[model samples]
Target: MALTQGIPNNIYGLHSAEEQFREKACSIIDADTGLQLHLAVTEAAMDMADVLRQFDTSDEDLKVAQILGMRTFNAFGASIKLTLSGYHQNSALILRDVMETVFLLDLFAGDRLLIERWRFADKKARMRDFSPVKVREALDARDGFTSKKRFEVYELFSELAGHPNMKSSWMMRPQRDGDAVIGPFMEATALEAVISEMGRLAVQVGEKLDHFFPANWDQCLPSRLAFTQLKLKWIKTFYAPAGGP
Candidate 1:
């Protein structure tokens, strides 16, 4: 199988050697299987979600859940409809797991079915040509019209903390200025808020998984969800745990 070289300038611009190496490694693996790895990993994640939805999650369910948990933590594609600017550096990693999990659930029917099978093997075409406009139109054309809910937050932390301005606008308050500590203090406070919310979300997620998967809920839920966090690229963005720099 021939692999494409030379990174495009439009998107994925100027990745580091390490990033390129990892992407290439992933590319090579996917090339042989015709991106079936993505589909399989995606399917596995859905199975895991299903297992979570079930009352009696078996050993096989737990195994699949763990694997899916890991995969969901590492597969995502994000686009900015607002602007080309303000793309988070490691945002891809952060949403990888959740996006794959959701995508598999919605796009595929518990099977590795494609919502658009043509996208997988269109050698002469490019995914970039699949415009956002077209996608929006398709969604609009769907029979089930109103009361659709958007997947706003990837995790509980995002729901609580809300999206922050990465470029913090420093306010010049002479009263608060005490040895270049204002920026640090604000950033720290923001971080603290994230951690607090994430902790709460963790508890909620644990309870939900327990409700869904009773058999392996106790045995695998912690490890599975923990793996989800581990594969996440930027934990700091969501809110680093307490005592973090």
Candidate 2:
């Protein structure tokens, strides 16, 4: 239950807005309230990492999937740290990367040949050849899971978070009254939703792999499922419109 255990207390120290703003910073936001949300996200990622570690990485498909899973875990951690430090914009961008990694994890889980080709292709060629839209479509067709709406939401959030447009820029801009603003604000509800999606996508990828390698998956399922249930409970309690009471 101690989610911060083993995680450095100072992971976000270097980026703290209070440290940077010194006296000029506006009132520091209390990130502690969302600690549980961060913990849930971290725990889910660590669970995935634990499951992947138990598998033999000698197989090319497993190796690539592990690599992608690890990357997703790292990004999940980074996004949480950034959000804690009041760098919500940066966190959003990282979440975008996490979204893509989730899609690729699913793709590579289903088809090893595609991953092999992607790995061997020239970097530039690979960049040109890679298409997330196509990949999602293929995954949807193959698995019968509709992800178009999910992808649309991901793209919208990514654009808002990554671009320098007026919408997102307001988060960090100062008011005409000389008040400093630190933003790209992430509400607890929004954070819960994002982390919930991340956890769900991870579990989905694991499920896909299970269909391919049932024996290898049996040992990991209990822990993964437990953590997933815990995450879902949290989401429903705090984020669900009718369930928060």
Candidate 3:
């Protein structure tokens, strides 16, 4: 068999069954023109990471916000990696984790006292007041938001991956009659949905960071620029709907 570079070419007996899968998968995904939007979204995440890193850590609040931003970025990166490897269900679970972090980060950014509470909250205290449901309730009740269910995305992802629900299982056994599929198999539609979901939530993350660093918002210029450029390129290449910046 021709060797796929950067992936183990030599394999003994059982290991031969798992040769070069990730390298080959990435090659196929990279070559697919139809996935430019997904590619653009991935690029946007990377660029945002760079932007998040540049924020000045002048105070404890800024430091916490920066840490939360970094954590969210890393979680998002993990989800992308899993999706690329055809582990959509696991990726969605990571996305669910990220959704909660983003919501809490938003609340903490808006309320300095919350950040202080979070920094030293005991396990029981955290579960009592800072659970996912509580965070959503607190954020939605905060001033300046639409007050409607602004964080139902967390629940949606929970159903899709976090909970032991039928929909979550469908990621593995997509076709009811089909066997439960395991690990690293190509599923274009599922991959697309995962990537699209990551891309959408990533935008929300950017917004949260932007709000967190309002005075330093100009520091995010590169991130916003990268997102805008990617969107324009996607529209130009794929004839996607245009949206103003």
Candidate 4:
């Protein structure tokens, strides 16, 4: 008798494993909670776009806002798509980029010097000093806001998800099942956390806008009201303890 007689010679096991992975991915990606989060982010981007359209592109603040809004929106959309496709780690990386954009926007909103520096950067050359940490620190110092904790948390999460270190590799470790090894499944919680953080940041940016440009709110009352209502609905549906059905 041959010693290797017990092994199956067909590719059925591989096919079965692939099917299991697909089913697992679908369950998390198609869940109601995830869908709600995605919708909330989408609505935020739409409202931001509407608000941006009200400002002339030639205005310095509007120019900065446009760049920040476009970059944040693109990163957020990419993150959502990556999460839905079972690329959770890369999604987190994109979410980290979203957070950076938010911090940059906040800094620009508070500091005239930074805004001028950004606006006057060489048109043909890329900005080489747009560090998120530095921007956050400057903004916090200028505004007396304590955002160090949140920035640290975002940095740690991004490193774990985006780096090529052991921590990132270990997250996808396969499970041993006799002679077979099953790969790691998608992590829905990570994507949920990203969405929640992004939502919070968006609300903060909106509040800042209202505080800094009260006249804009009055001028654009109808649009502002619509945006505020959308934000409130999102909070009630996904964040409030007694709200979601």
Candidate 5:
């Protein structure tokens, strides 16, 4: 396998990354080696999108669930692509949003009245009730600590990339000594674990809507989860149960 060397940036010296891409008509930096390992991860997410788009439902509430499902998976897919595109911070930022929506989806699943509240919430009501902190707190309270430690992961991404602060500067800097540029730079493992969780949660939300749209989900998305577990086992060949990008 050909390994990435030096700064694996899309941007070249006078040519901007966009211009370089336009000239080449495709990515100049080859990521096929890393990409092949993630095909299952991409496919799992894609399958969920397929389910959300085509599944039939008579319930109006389920239709609403479908829309939110689409939003959740669309953002999930965007985060994955952003990571591949070499925008780790931007990817983290988007993944943070995915986590937030997944939490909301879980809450909506249990008591969809909350969804109505959320849908009709004024700006002030939203800030007061549906904020990330409030939402995580609610989930932790409801699930008896399913979200207790998960919130820590959400906080990590939020601090590192979601909000502008001193810590975020590290995102633009290289791991080794060097200058930095507004990136399109490589970070193959930046959010691997969180992204794995995002994939699971995206499908989890889909499962909640299974009552609305009947399909053979157990053998489909759930089985993929069983096999891959989204852990990217390829990194260690044995340490992780599955390969990840």
Candidate 6:
């Protein structure tokens, strides 16, 4: 989670803010906390990597796979880095990429569970903190798709999800896998970044609202959207291969 010093702006921070907006849009409570959701994502990722190595592919493909695998890992790490820096946009973008790319990979059913967990986390945040911010509304949802390759790679996960898992041994129960990834993957620095960013944005938005509007906008926003609805919407809008990064 320790990003190299002098890291730039927060892409993920903005993403997180968007997610909060979505949750507020629907008034849902996510089942997982930020820390818990983060751990679920990391643990599920490791589990997925273990499953992928079992396939016997060509050396060339394997090498490519290895690079992609590392990319997945690094994507998560980048999120942690953003979290530590308290950069909401950067951390949120990383988290969104991880979900759209690696977490959606269909290798392990655990990935599905993890995605649900993230939704749950956002939902929880929305419910606990209902303060609505004065958004620019200038953020074109289109701006999120700057990397076409990243978008294509994430879509592959949806394509793969069509195939069903046939083995019983691969199954994992939620309680049994509880928060295992938090300690290892959600580093202290990462946790600090996420909490700090969320808190900071809340303040910024609150001030903006107070400055522009006559009354509080807190009650108008919902906590979170339905998970399935949010996922499908994100897949269509942000994961377009033409503009994804």
Best by TM-score: 3
For model 6, give the RMSD to the true fold.
Answer: 23.7
Residue-level lDDT tens digits of model 1 in 62-136: 444444434442332221100012222222223423433433332222222233442353643424322323322
List runs of model 1 lying over 4 Å from the truth.
Answer: 1-69, 74-93, 109-112, 115-119, 123-189, 192-245
Instruction: Name the candidate that leads on lDDT.
Output: 3
What C-alpha lDDT, on a 0 to 100 scale, does residue 9 get in candidate 3? 38
Clash number by candidate, in order:
3, 0, 0, 0, 6, 31
Task: Tell me which residue pairs clash in candidate 5.
Answer: 232-242, 232-243, 232-244, 233-242, 233-243, 234-243
The number of clashing residue pairs in model 1 is 3
Q: List model 2 lDDT by residue over 156-218, tens digit each.
A: 765657787766663353332333354434344444444445555554444443333336457
Scored by CA lDDT, what does every candidate get? 0.34, 0.60, 0.70, 0.60, 0.61, 0.35
Candidate 5: where are CA atoms >4 Å away?
Answer: 1-39, 176-179, 191-245
> What TM-score against the true fold does each predicted structure earn?
0.28, 0.65, 0.74, 0.66, 0.66, 0.27
| Candidate with the larger TM-score of 4 and 6 | 4
**Candidate 1, position 101, lDDT:** 40
Q: What would the per-residue lDDT of candidate 5 be over residues 44-126, giving only the tens digit for each residue? A: 54465556656576666666767866776678677766655556678678777777777777778778788778877899999
- State the TM-score for model 1: 0.28
Error of 1 at 171 (Å): 15
Residue-level lDDT of model 3, residues 44-89, one tens digit each, is 7556655767766677766777788788878887887777666788
Give lDDT for model 4: 0.60
Q: Where is model 3 more than 4 Å wrong at Cα?
A: 1-35, 56-58, 143-152, 174-177, 214-220, 228-245
Give all candidate RMSDs, comma-separated: 15.6, 8.6, 6.1, 8.3, 8.9, 23.7
lDDT of 6 by residue, 200-234 (tens): 22222222222211133343222111222333343
